[model samples]
Target: MLDPISILNLIDDVMYFPILIIVMAIAGLYFTFKTRGVQIRLFGESLRILLEPPDKEGAVSSLQAMLVSTASRVGTGNIIGVSTAICLGGPGACFWMWLMCIIGASSAFIESTLAQIYKQKDHKGHAYGGPAYYIEHGLSKPKLAVLFCIFLILTYAVGFNMLCSFNLQSTFIDYSFYNPTTTPVIIGAILAILTGYCLLGGGKRIIKITSTVVPFMGISYVIIALIVIIFNIYYVPSMFELILKDAFDFTSIFGGLAGSCMVYGIKRGLFSNEAGVGSAPNASASANVSHPAKQGLVQTLSVYIDTLLLCTATALMCLSTGIPITPAVSGAPYVQNAIGSVFGPIGPIFITVAMVLFAFTTLIGNLYYVDNALIFLNGKTKPSEKFMRIFHVCCAFIVFIGATISMDAAWAMADITMGGMTLINLPVCMLLGKIAIDCLKDYEKQRKMGQEPVFKAESIGFEKGELDFWD
Candidate 1:
């Protein structure tokens, strides 16, 4: 029988590797033009919303919604992913990443906006909406909706969700300098306790945790990278030129460039911010906002935080340090080593703490995603309680995998699974673009008129009919 790896490789080599990038890129480009560059118009507004008070009708506050998404976005992927991309694809990958982010931002807004515009509520008065519901209810295609949800439930629960734990457990075991089997078991124990805390508390608690940890960890890493950049400020100009030269040189069939780093960087960038992937919509839909467009704006802004702010910092830190990482280093730990090459002993300690914060919060945040997917697929989910519990246990097991599994395998699995999530989400966004734009115009109208930005769901004038879930 073929192994699981073979199956994954076959699907990836033949199918996912191509359409995933093309469709996502096209979607991003299309949205950029369609929104009249809304990503640019509302860029500052996205940040401004964080400071303002939330509208109180939604399940969570605006800041909390961003945090929940950030919790998942700012993981080992930000640092290690960036570093790996730079090492293989070279510094030029960073620029390509920024390009992708700029375009992808609008797509992020469109998908997330639709999620809010077509939300479906539970009997408990809490809101539940994402690509799954949007595809089903907005597009009026239950089969396609179920397919999306099934892929998401599997990707979030089995592929991505557990991987976060594995990264955490394994990171700590190495930091603790422990033995082989003991490390994973001990790490699993710690992860189990923490996972239980957030999983039991629900999305509210998960968002609450993210609001505290995500910024702290992300900003902290940026500060650390800043120090490295400062010491190498003199080379900054030459570095930029080098980056530009390598990126455009073109790799392989494209050109003379090595292409390894270029491919890795773009792939890792996508893996990091997850814009246009539809997963963040699950988190964004819970926010009580003045408008659906407002939530979508913030969702797009998060790609900047994940890719431009956090991931770019990792790239600068590694590139400036002159580390011997021209060949990819795996995840956050490689970043730790690169920093340590410059900062000495404190480097590992700093990264260890950052990774713990990054991976732990990711676990909590992604588990909540798993929970949302479960609740979405199985309405009245009490019957799936046992399965949910089993899912939780498997989550702990996956954490062990991240902790001990090969980085190549881990990275490949994440990118492939994330591609899976994006495939389900991007199609719905394109099909429902008109609804998203209508929501954006309504939001702008309310804000422009000096109103408090509260409009009834029906008044937004999207294509969808029912939006009582958010009421």
Candidate 2:
């Protein structure tokens, strides 16, 4: 008989393999072709628009919105998750992860573009939208939108937050004073309290916090990774060869597709960058941009930063160290040890500090998405302030519970819920993809005409009343 954890893993596998993988690959390729490779072609434009100030003084800037999404994307998954992928899937996992990001960036463009096109305004005149908003407003499918919201809330607020909590606490396991039974509880409580205080301050607080913390931690971690790589520069060529060799190892792929590097690579990539998983679109929608495609392009850049830059840093730091990739040292321990070997005692301490910042920002950023989901679930009305307070407390409690759970169970729950979100979001994005493509065309036409691109719903055959913002 299968236990609960086994059942969860089984469901995750069934969801991801064959069905999820095929859908994601097809959708990514389809969008890449349809957009004429927007992720690549508009790369420079994304950078330019990223620096544009918000039209209004207090509104969220494109860079701020990207940072919010980046805070979520560049968390434990970049470090511990990358380590786990290498340990379980071999050096080849890095190759697949890079490939996945390239393909998935197109999907990110479509979904985030759709979010901007279909975004709604709250009573306070703040923009808020995501997969649920676009699904309802763009597709005119209210029921399906609510379903997406439920799945999103479950995935981000509960499952992913739990995994973040577990990953953070796991870092303390190697310390001399660490106690398995008592340490987790104490750490969980402290984390929960800190998170609860932040959550009560609302979305602006999340934006402020992420925009400040993400850049510092991300740049610092990448710099350290570069130092480690430089110290082991001789191993670079062989590392590349191993990655390529393992990525296409047809023998092992045919033997057990589930255990292959491709599977783990894609899983970790999806979990880390969240390009098409529909989470980033919530942040993308909040950006006060002149054209929807601008935010879309910025988000595409975000995927590259998350997977190509940060995750690659973690992978090379570990693999280039010539450390043995084994199941026993998978996840956080592997990363800590890899760094510890390079910098001695200071290495592990740096990792622990990095994880704390990464995981804490992730917790708040994930809740930011949940705020959008909850708003949509409440019939496009913001939930009462009292209700929000209660929800925040409940979320903090979930974090505590997550910290005390087994790693397997936490990850299993996250994978299944995340898969559920992807299954709904991808097909919906495919249906509404044409609008985003047209928006891109309109933006480019204006750009070529030497004019700043500003969106108007009527210009794209969307009736004035059809949209909440652009109209």
Candidate 3:
């Protein structure tokens, strides 16, 4: 009989490969066509809106919201996950990852646009919404909305956060002082304590931290990647050739279809960018933009930043080093070795610090989404302060448990929950995508007329009181 971990992996493969992959591809294509490829046509607008100030001083701005979502999107999946994909699936996986990001960005635009359309404001005038809010109001499926929130909590808080903790601790294995038994325990305790401190400070703290850390870590990592690439400049052309050749190797793709480059690429790409996975929409919905589509457009840029920039940086950094990418060197070790090949001991140390920053921000950014879900679950009101405190403690405990658990278990759990969220969110986005497209058209019309795009629910046929914010 297969062991529990093996079984979990099997289920994850079955869930993603033919089922979720097909659904995601179709949804991505559908949205791209329906929105007339808004992700591409309005790419400049996304950048423009990123600098626009929020209507109120205290509200979340477009840039801050994108950073929050980017915090969750650009985590261990960019480094460890990309290394694993290249090792298991070959350099061709990078090609598929790039393809998925370009296509999947359209889906990101749709879901986040819908989120802004259906967002609700708290008593403090803070805006919040997500897949659940849109499903409830736009689709009028309250039960299904609640179910989506349940899945969000499971996926973000329990599954993804655990995986982050585990990935962070796994980096310590390379150090001479690392004791498998004690190191994980020590790392877990420290991570949990830091996470608790941030979580207790609430949403603003999460946003503040992510906004500060994400830019610095992202820029620093990219700079390191550029240096690695520059050092291996002679191999750059051949590396590109290898990636393209492997990507289209029909025999390899069919022979081991489940383990092919396409499968791992799409899987890791989805996990990394979260373009259609419904997670980023929670952060996207929080932005106080003049038009719903402004935040949506801003979010599309985030997908590129995560996959096209960050994930690609990691993939090329590893592939250019000419390292043997066997399964044994699949995750952090491969990245460490690749960077170490260029910069020696300091390379591994830098990656460890990168992983720490990546995973820590991901933990808190993920909890921000969990906080939104918890409020929705509690009748769209804030949970009791005591209950929230208890919840944060439990979250910290899960982070601790995650660090000590088997990596296979951590990944499998995250994949399953993430897959569930994608399956639920994608179909719903397709069904309600027309509203988002209409919103986009309105925004475009205003822009063409040299006026700022302002959204009113009635412009898209939504009635008075149909939406909490726009109406």
The backbone clash count of each candidate, in order, is: 10, 0, 0
Residue-by-residue lDDT tens digits, candidate 1, 1-471: 977766665565443345776787899989888888998887887888776666654458777888778778888777666766776666788888888888888888998888887776667766668887888778888888777777776666656655665665544433657676677677766666666555544556655665586677677778888988898788778778877786776544155222444555567778788888888988888887767787888887788888888888887777776666546354555677777876888887878777777776776667667677767677626436677666776666666555555545665577677777788788778988888887788778888898756656677553344666544
Q: How many backbone clashes are present in model 3?
A: 0
Query: Residues 62-174, candidate 2, lDDT per residue (tens digit)?
Result: 99999888878889999988988888878888998999899999999999999999888877788888888888878889999888889999998999999999999999988
lDDT of 3 by residue, 1-471 (tens): 999989989999899878999999999999998888889988888888999999888889999999888877889999999998898988899999999999999999999999999988887888989999999988999999898989999998899999999999988888999999899999999999888887787556655765686679789999999999999999999999999999999899989977899999998899999988998889888999899999999999999999999999999999899999898888899999999999999999999988988888888778888988898999988899999999999999999999999978998899899999999999999899999999999999999999998888889898899899876
Model 2 poorest ten-residue lDDT run: 202-211
Ranking by lDDT: 3, 2, 1
Please list the C-alpha lDDT of all candidates, in the order they appear.
0.73, 0.89, 0.91
Let me know the TM-score candidate 3 reaches against the reference structure.
Answer: 0.96
Off-target runs (Cα >4 Å) in candidate 3 are 200-214
Report the CA-based lDDT of candidate 1 relative to the real structure.
0.73
State residue 30's C-alpha deviation in candidate 2, in Å.
0.3
Which regions in candidate 2 have their CA more than 4 angstroms from the true location? Answer: 201-214
